[model samples]
Target: MDIQTILQELELLSTERTKKTYIRNGAHEPLFGVATGAMKPLAKKLKKNQGIAEELYATGNYDAMYLAGMIADPSAMSEADFDRWMGTAYFYMISDYIVAVTLAETDIAQAVSDKWIASGKELFMSAGYSCYCWLLGNRKDEEFDQEKLNKMLEIVEKTIHNSPNRAKYAMNNFVTTVGISYMPLHERAVAVANAIGKVEVSSVKTKCNVPLASEAIQKAVDKGQLGFKRKNVRC
Candidate 1:
C-alpha cells in the first residue's frame, strides 16, 4: 500500500463525525492504541516522507503522534529526539504507544520486557504481552507446549479481569487481537469470565463473529475439549 495514501485516508476517516465521537467521548485513547499496533509499518514508511510526516505531526492528533512514534528509528534517534517528539510535540499522547512501538521494533525483547515489567503501566504491559504472544505463536516448533500457551492465556485473562474501567476497552482490544480465532482464545475467555465473575462469553463470540466460529467453539466446549489441548488453534 502507498503509505502516504493510507495515512491520508486515515486522516480523513478520523475527521468524520463518527470517528470524532470516539475522541470527544474519550474512547480515542484505546482506539489509538489499536491503530498504533496495526499501523506501525505504515508509520515507519511515512516517517521517511517529510511532508506527510510534518502534516501528520502538525495535526497534533493523538493517533498521529502515536503513529509518528511507531515510525521513529530508535537507532538513529537521540535522547533529544525523543524529548522533542514526545515532550514537545504530542503531550496529549499516551506513553504506552511509545513503549509499544519500541518493543515491537527492537530486537531486544528481554530488555523491553524488563522495562515494561518495571514500569507497571497497564497499557504498556498489555502491549508487551501482545508482542510476546505474537512472537511465541509464530515461532517454529515441533510441538506446541500447552503449558506456555496456558500461561499466555492466563496473562490475558488476568489483564481483562483486573483492568480498570478506563482501560477495559484497551484490554478488550488486546484480547480480541491476540485471541482472533486461536482455540486457546476459548480457554482464555472462560478464564477471564471466571476471574471477573461474569458469564459473558459474547466477547469471544464477537471477536470471531465475522467468520461465525461461535458455534464451533460452543460445540467444542460442550464436548469437554475446548482448552489449549485442541490442535486446531489457528483459524
Candidate 2:
C-alpha cells in the first residue's frame, strides 16, 4: 500500500468525533498523539511500501516518519536516512522501533545503542537502557558483559526510583521489550517490578503483545468495535 492509500484508510477509520475528542484531551497538538492513534495501522501498511513511506516521511508528518522507522526495511535504509529519522522520532516510537531494529538486524546494534544513550529524553534513555539489556541477554556474538549489565541495572533502578509514576509506562515498555528479546531477562523484569514497587509485572508482560495483522485487522472489521467501518473491501 502507498501513503495515500494509508492516509485514506486512516480518514475512513477515524471519525470527526474521535478527532475532536483527541483535541479535547489536549493530545492533538503533540505529534505523538497522532502516532498513538494512527501510526500503528500505518506501520503495518508501510511494511510493504518502503519508498512511499520514505516520501511521506519527508513531507513533515512526524507520525508517518515515526511509523516509517517502525516498519521500513532497516537494512535498505541508508545510514544518513536512519540517523535523520532517529533524530526526529518520538521517544516512545524510538523505543519501540529500537526493539524492531534489534530483532531484525544485529549489525546496527551498537550504533542504535549509542543513539539511545544520547537521546537524553528520560523515556528514550530508559528505553536505551532496556534495549542494551536485551542485547546482552539475547545476542550471542558477544558474551554478557557484567560491567554493562551493572550499568543497565543502575539506570533502570535510578529511573524507577526517581520518577515512579511518570516513568511507569515507559519502564513497562522497556521491560516488555527486553522480555520479548530475551525471556531470561524475566528476572531483571521482576527486579524492575520491585524497584517500581508494583505487586505485579503484568504491564511488562503485555508490552510486547503485537498482534498479527489478520487478527488486528479482523478486530477493526468486526461490527461494534471501535475503528470498525462497514464497506465493501476484502481483507
Candidate 3:
C-alpha cells in the first residue's frame, strides 16, 4: 500500500485514549496514536517494503514510524540507513521499540548497537541496550559470544545506576532478558540483577517506578520460561 492510504487507515484506527496515552509517554504532535495491534492487518498486507517504510518513517508520524518498522526489510538496511533512522528517533518509544527492534533483525545489529551503546547519548544508549535485549530474546544462544555478554553484564553491574534513566531501564531489561533467554549466562545474569537491585527511572509524567531485574527474571523462571526465545523480534 502507498503511504497516503496507509496513513489514512492509521488515522481511522486512532483513538483519543491511545493518543492521550502516547502524549503522556512523551509523544508529540503529528501522530495518529494507532495501537500496535491495530497495525497488524496493514502490516500483513504490505509485508516488507523498504521504500514505503522509508516514506512513512520520514513523515515523522508516530504510527507511521511504527508501521515503517513493521514493514521494513532489515536485510536491506545498511548501518548508515539504521543510523539515519536512529537520528530521528526523538523518544524511547521510537528509539528502543522501533529503531532498535528493526536493527535487531539486521546482520550489523551487534556492531551498530555497540557503537550506539558507546555513543554516550541517552536515547542511543537506551536503543543500544534494547537492541541487545531483542537479540537475546530472538536469536539462538549459540549465535552470541558468551564472553562478550559476560562483559556486558559486568558493565551493567558497574554502571547501570549511573546511566541515563531510559538506558538504565533498557540495561535492566538486558539483564532480565539474559537470565531468561541466554542459558549460558543465566546464573551470571541472575547474580548481576541481584547485585544491581532496584533501578529507578523517572518518567515524563513525574511517576518514578523501580524496575527490578531480579524480580522479572524470577517471574520468567517461575513460569518455567528459562532459555526462552522468540520466533520473531517484530510483531
Candidate with maximal TM-score:
3
Backbone-clash count (model 3)? 0
Would you list the C-alpha lDDT of every candidate in the order shown?
0.44, 0.47, 0.93
Candidate 3: worst-modelled 10 consecutive residues by lDDT: 202-211
User: How well does each candidate superpose onto the true structure, as a TM-score?
Assistant: 0.44, 0.53, 0.97
At residue 157, give the lDDT of candidate 2. Answer: 56
Taking the tens digit of each residue's C-alpha lDDT, what string does model 2 give over 1-235? 6667755555555555655654443233333334244556666645545677577666454444545545555566655665565455444444434433432344565566556556665544544555554554345523445455445545655764444322344444454444333344445644554554541222322433222322322343353342222231111
For candidate 3, write residues 1-235 as lDDT tens digits: 6678888999999999999999888899899889999999989999889999999999999999999999999999999999999999999999999999999998999999999999989999999999999999999999999999999999999999899988998899999999999999999999999999988877656757666889999999999999899899998
> Largest lDDT belongs to which candidate?
3
lDDT of 1 at 173: 39
Off by over 4 Å in 3: none
Per-residue error at 157 for model 3, in Å? Answer: 0.8
lDDT value, candidate 1, whole model: 0.44
Task: Put the candidates in TM-score order, highest first.
Answer: 3, 2, 1
Off by over 4 Å in 2: 1-6, 17-47, 66-71, 90-106, 126-147, 163-168, 176-185, 198-235
Clashing pairs in 3: none
Show how many residue pairs clash in every candidate, following the order shown: 0, 0, 0
lDDT of 2 at 145: 55
